[model samples]
Target: MQWQNVAINKMIEEAILEADKKGTKVVSLGLMNQGEELNIYGGLYVSRHPKLKVKIVDGSSLVVALVLNTIPKGTTQVLLRGKLNKVAYAIAFKLCQQGIKVATMHEDDYVKLKKSFNSSEANLVVALNFTQTVWLVGEGLTEEEEMKAPKGTLFIPYSQFPPKKYRKDCSYHYTPSMVAPNSVENLHSCEDWLPRRVMSAWRIAGIVHSLEAWNEHECGYTMHNIDMVWNATLQHGFQPLNLPNHTVIT
Candidate 1:
């Protein structure tokens, strides 16, 4: 649908009003609707409707949590590519805290991402090449840039949208998602692009928020505690996906 952004926002505002009227506890923003470019991560709605009873959540923290857990084992370093959004910064910060190197391709990006960390944090330096096998990517990836990866390099996306698959030698993962436990009634089919029974972290975050009864909005520059959201998701029986050994396309 070629819906104009203003019309989309109007529809969203209408839904928020409807949900609030029905005593809905929380309303999570879907993919593009929560973008920094769209509605300031859903903040614009909250600012417009200040007296709303339903809390607005962007689910960014859980999105970051899922991306962090998705990184493969034994990775000492990973490349950070694409636009640096809210989730990108959080991932870089957590990885640096865990002593993992977050490599950048440009000095300008390095300078900008470096300011996010302190001297105590691990490396966030400019890498002249794609030496690391794991790449953490977000928006703004191009097909031309995708061709530069070494064979078998894994692309894990934190963006709401997935990147195009142009390199068959390289592997692409589904956007941040997890397996909903069997107890989740009637979850027999895939949720969007995810495999069967797997759910988007963004959707799961709203379920967790309501279960926890959190009254705060997680939109705009605000983020829920990553550890808290992850633990709560696990406590509520969501499990991380165990990727197959050979993930590369044939």
Candidate 2:
């Protein structure tokens, strides 16, 4: 993985430059391209090419929007477990602001998230009870952890991929995504693990970004208005999907 870093970065840089040359308005970064460790979600390219015309979007805001909205209605509390990212942080903060309690399974994560809160010590608390049936899951979730969850627990993933189906009793949700509208023609193939006509939130974010003609670059740690992006996506006919937990749904 480390060996391919330089080559991949070079390829990405070249592609960005090529997009600029062709007058492409925006280029959206996919899941792995975020490069949380190597680059700050495509910030390296922006830093290297200050005058680059093509805007870059990591699609974090839209992803956050999808995750937040996809959360089961009436959920007052949720278990947040996974490797924390920009979107995770944003989701936690927004959840706190909305008065929804976010319980962290790890002490390190709890302390870090608490420090992120700054002054007000509210919402984020230790996970003593897996009483909450809904778990906001992401990468680094293991089979052992899945086993700890109560029976019939819904593991809703907010990442690029879904969790392994280790527990037959516990349901694993499809990655946060939206169903493409009937107007979307020429979509013969399904995207990744999503069902037919369902598009990843990342790709749909770019579509909304272009539709809105947003001038600001959405790359790096910068976040656009989550509600605004969600509303615009809906206005453009992108429908929120009832994510599949048991199996893929067409």
Candidate 3:
């Protein structure tokens, strides 16, 4: 929706009012609602509004935090396929800090990355800039030629909608450890306000936001440092993989 559209803005304003009525102090805007191009920081508008009575935050920062925490330690060769947006850059920076070798390519070059690195060498593959047109079907493996990761390879793909259908043939088929949930229902109910991906982002954002709020008052210091925020959020539980039944090559 157009950011300046009076109807959409009014709807957001109304949602803020409703949240305030319920004594909610923090409000999170997810997905398109918080896009920089459309809204130019819509969360800031709600936060600065005198009548809103809520702290507003866009959850992208938290998503970055989760991705960092999800990556396994001692992982050396990492392939990042996505636009080098702020989120992608943040992930790269964090990985560098951890002494991991990182390679990044635009979405169009994904096939090249696939041909170049297999699970035997690449420790992890993260697909951040995914659109409907781009997905995670393996390069050559298909329904008839099922392949498994050469043990220890990890794949993490972000989806704004329901995840695409799983391909049993693909290497590294398991979900990321940090974002996994026991079931889809645990992620969100049908009545939830946002789609699953957006909801997940908002949920993770709330985790860090709550910590920052507490640290400010209790520690007399702000937790704006991403590293500290990451460590703090790690105390919260991250679910393990819920993979489909398939042979995982070791």
- Using lDDT, give the best candidate's number: 1
lDDT of 3 by residue, 1-250 (tens): 4556556666766786787789876666654454444444464354446565555655555556656655555555566543333455455556655666555434444444434334232423433422212122212223321222223334554323323334433334332223423332445432142324322654555555664574221111111456555565555543433333453423
- TM-score of candidate 1 against the unseen true structure: 0.90
Worst 10 residues of 2 by lDDT: 241-250
Better of 2 and 3 by TM-score: 2
Best by TM-score: 2
Residue 30 shift from truth in candidate 3, angstroms: 3.6
* Tens-digit lDDT string for candidate 2 (1-250): 7668778888888999999999999998866777577668888899999998888988889889988987888999999999898888889999999999999988999988888778576899999877878889989998888888888788888888878888767677778778888989988535667788888888888888887899878887788999999899999998887746554322
Root-mean-square deviation of each candidate, in angstroms?
2.5, 2.3, 9.3
Tens digits of lDDT, candidate 1, 21-122:
999999988666777777888999989989999999889999999999899878999999899888998899889888889998778877777776655454
Alpha carbon lDDT of each predicted model: 0.85, 0.84, 0.45
The parts of candidate 1 lying over 4 Å away from their true place are 1-3, 117-122, 188-190, 244-246
Q: How close is every model to the real structure, measured as TM-score?
A: 0.90, 0.94, 0.55
